[model samples]
Target: MSKEDTSLRFRQFEADDAPVVYSFCLQLIFKQSCWQLRKKTMLNRGWMISAVTASVLLAIGLSWPVTLITSLLCTYLLIWISHTAYSYYLRHNRYQDLCSTAAFVARWCSGGQDRLFVATLEDGTVIASSGIVHQDIDTCELVRVATEESYQRKGVGRALMKYVLRQSTSFGYKTVVLKTSDVQTEAQRLYETSGFSLSKIYTVGRGIMTVYYYKLNLTDH
Candidate 1:
């Protein structure tokens, strides 16, 4: 469900609409992946160096030795925790975005029968998008589903999902499957609400990450 109440317009995505659609895609893709956040915050090399230097100076400038030492230890501990968490976040998001985009292109754009759709705002901004690709003779894979952060929970995602599911059924697919990460709890909830059942949950890129597979039988719909 989207957080916005405004109704959105639905349309087919155009490769030629590069100025808006493609540009938005790039920003949203990287932003949602934390690429931009990492670049601007302590997760970045430059900011990281500055933050560490500032922390060390602050600790050293403290009047009390015990306080200074404890502050230094805390600062290092905080940096380590932040770095580790950001590393995990970037790892999962980057891997998923790259793989999802590749699969979407191969399975959806490569085939004339495959479908891609985008949601636009009343002001003509493309804010949400999704695409589906053929996985096998009877299975279709849902990929590249994304809704702008501000527009989430309002209906952009729900509308896109509903359209894709209906299209998949009409296109002769027996089952529709998609991958969602443990971090995407809201997305998983939506999928479950839409009748998708958890088929499997698998760990990837060390035990710190988990990916869920959800499948919906179109024939039952």
Candidate 2:
């Protein structure tokens, strides 16, 4: 082909690539939009709590110095309570189906044979999810399987767990480990159903943690 014709063809190819680049840009923008919306929702929930706390502190500021200090302290305490309540409400509202403390631990034990698994939801809503990496007594692994809370009880977590286990087997890991707080009894039950068993009990901060360890036989992998 003539040099000019060849250069023209290359230019056409580059021009045709525009749509792919544009689509990627659009995808990135939508993802960012989702994150911003979630943040705004969280901030709105926090606003009322912050306003009430500020008002209480302002009211106390009118009193004598000692009383004012006491009032401010009380206001801060109230603010803290409000923040906690708001967070609980958000989680409860957002993730109703995620198994409770015990279930998560059980799943961990059942799948704890892999050295690593990536855990997370398909979408980017909940960050504190299965894709998290945990270091058991001997192995370090990723928890790549997780289901959205809204889809729990419908076999979402189970499916994700199974997928992760398979992936772990393919990845050539021998075992995986996980822990769930005993407070989550429902989660504990779920884990049992998923073939996980309780392995040990430990403590973190003020909460008693249940550790479930699961080993995948690589021969079957």
Candidate 3:
């Protein structure tokens, strides 16, 4: 094969690698976000144990004294770990800021016909305000809802809730589902007022946050 052809194949391989890396990064960000939100610290003692083993193996191949090389490599590994943790911190924080908004704006902008609805503010500032997420099973299921702190208590959340329910009704979905933290009393009240009935309690990570699932039936619409 020609060198140019080989190079082109290598570039394609690299492009595929980029998406895999992005997916891994996004997964880590999500895990870290949940950990952060729940105040759960991921104890990583095994990484240190594994790093020590790696350093010992590397030092054996080095001409330098084993202690010196092992120490240096171990230090380097620790530094890299710290750097990775800090990068994850920055990435999730930034992503939370960017995605914290009216998700319907995205749907509106994309003219998406899918069950999701998203919206943004007028000033190019993402309202991060209240937003709704829905899934159609036998009916429209309110999968999730989130709103930025600054935009809460003003009915943006209720509006999104109603919007999703209306969309579900139009789509011929019979039910909507959602789960909320028990600590969020106001949110629970809002959901009840919107015609949602409590279903069950769920315990997530750390078992500290109690989540209550609610369902709303769309018979009238």
Candidate 4:
């Protein structure tokens, strides 16, 4: 362990940490949702149709100025559509529903068999958090793993993950599972390095969003 890792401490989630954790979860969801929507818009058939229409107009002997203007208008329309879709997603997505209130998030994190862990500095500032929730008798789901942006690239996230896994084992879970979206490449890498294997892939939002499910068998670890 590095000196920075040694300076970090891990503890269970407290009531005061609810607001911070909820904010962190919201930030991550918003960022991932925006990226996913933007990428989908760029790759969707709408852009291809726009290009084909512009080409056909030019081929039909329209003036260069007209073709250019039409293409620019198409581009603006697509941008507006993307923005509208993102707004609608933010309003109706399940993530927003689950994180709708700090009180709800607090109850979810600490209720029943769910457990949330946080990594803090000596001064009690939470830099990272990870949660384990009951999935079944022998399985647990990992959720809401997040790190402060300024404190990322350090060992904070990894340490928090380790703590969560330890707690999962202590709770007699045989497997640990987590779901992350396709846009979270860094998080995917972290989970892979930590011994989680990709077990399933599914799409939501009318197939515009891709979600990956990863699992770690604690018995093998």
Most accurate candidate by TM-score = 4
lDDT for residue 40 in candidate 4, whole number 0-100: 63
TM-scores, one per candidate: 0.63, 0.38, 0.45, 0.79
Query: Whose TM-score is higher: candidate 2's or candidate 3's?
Result: 3
The C-alpha RMSD of each candidate to the native structure, in angstroms, is 7.2, 16.7, 16.2, 3.5
Clashes of each: 9, 30, 11, 0
C-alpha lDDT values of all predictions? 0.66, 0.41, 0.49, 0.78
Model 1 quality (TM-score): 0.63
lDDT of 2 at 131: 40
- Where model 4 places Cα greater than 4 Å from the true spot, the runs are 1-4, 44-46, 52-93, 96-101, 104-106, 205-207
Encode model 2's per-residue lDDT on 1-221: one tens digit a residue: 12112111100112222233223323322233234433443444445554555567667664455555655565555545544564455335642222243333343334544222222333422311234244443343533333333444555455445555565455555565555544445556766666665666776423212344443343444
Question: How does model 3 fare in lDDT?
Answer: 0.49
Worst 10 residues of 2 by lDDT: 4-13
Cα RMSD, model 4: 3.5
Better of 1 and 3 by TM-score: 1
Kindly provide the TM-score of model 4 when superposed on the true structure, using C-alpha atoms: 0.79
